[model samples]
Target: MSADTADGDGSEEAVADEETAADDAAADTYTVAVDRDACDGVFACLVRDDRFREDDDGLAGFDPETADALERSEASVQATFTDDRLEDARAAAAACPFDAITVETQ
Candidate 1:
């Protein structure tokens, strides 16, 4: 009557755990980037994704409070997020007039 008994060798539970772990990992890893050189202060990305905000230089940047990691340089800014919001980031990238935004799945 144990849980393992329902699956003989407990392989069912192990398979389920592995699938869940893979799903979690896939759901929680993505990166969003902004090419500062191409950005034109349009703020289109901000409207599509709240995580994107206006930085001091009037370009797209990530909100430190929400982004898991933020990196910046003179030419670009990149943010890593551990959340199920890849579509939101994609929308932001699509909305950019200058094609400055990019989103990649990890």
Candidate 2:
């Protein structure tokens, strides 16, 4: 039989097919980039994750260069895989009243 056709056994092949379909629909990587130029320093994202912080002036304060480096080497806000609800990420992205947080999938 072909991959597109399923047997009545509901066996490993069926599971594999479903898994493949899910993988196909899923994105390989995710990126959360803050457009600091447009950032209003809203701390909503900071409140959600300590990785985000504000400057002494109470504006969005995380170091982009540092964050970019960390994200590339270690912890990545974008590449993080979450079976948990994407609520936090989505909230962080939306919390930017200034539209600074941009989340993209690839």
Candidate 3:
């Protein structure tokens, strides 16, 4: 029943290493959103995540009919996680078919 028991010091180190790597990966990542009023519903971010969605007004606006819908539409499509990817978000804004998406950051 207890045939395999060890100090497990190496396991802790391995977990720490994994956490460090994750932090590094996320360090450059942040959060992004669309202006909705400036979006044209081109859905270029559909490949990134299902969070992005086309506006109901037919102008690529960020529809907020439901919390889940809003979250999904804003999760990946019209949003990003690059701390220094404002340029990338700008490109998305420019790529909008209706020029209705606007990205902002701090």
- For lDDT, the strongest prediction is 1
Clashing pairs in 3: 30-81, 38-100, 38-101, 39-100, 39-101, 51-72, 51-73, 52-73
Task: Write candidate 2's Cα lDDT for 3-84 as tens digits.
Answer: 8755577797878999999876653344566665676666888766555666554555444543333242222223333223
lDDT of 1 by residue, 1-106 (tens): 4564654778789989999997777576888999999999999898989988899988889899998889999999999998888889999999898999888887
Model 1's lDDT to the true fold?
A: 0.88
Best by TM-score: 1
Instruction: Compute each candidate's TM-score over C-alphas.
Output: 0.75, 0.47, 0.35
Winner on TM-score (1 vs 2): 1
lDDT values, one for every candidate: 0.88, 0.56, 0.49
Q: Rank the candidates by lDDT, best first.
A: 1, 2, 3
- Per-residue lDDT of 1-106 in model 3, one digit per residue for the tens? 7757546658877988999897665435333456554555557754333334555554343334321223334423343344444455566566656655555453
Instruction: Flag regions of model 2 displaced more than 4 Å.
Output: 1-28, 61-87
Residue-pair clashes per prediction, in order, are 0, 2, 8
- Give the Å error, residue 86, model 1: 0.4
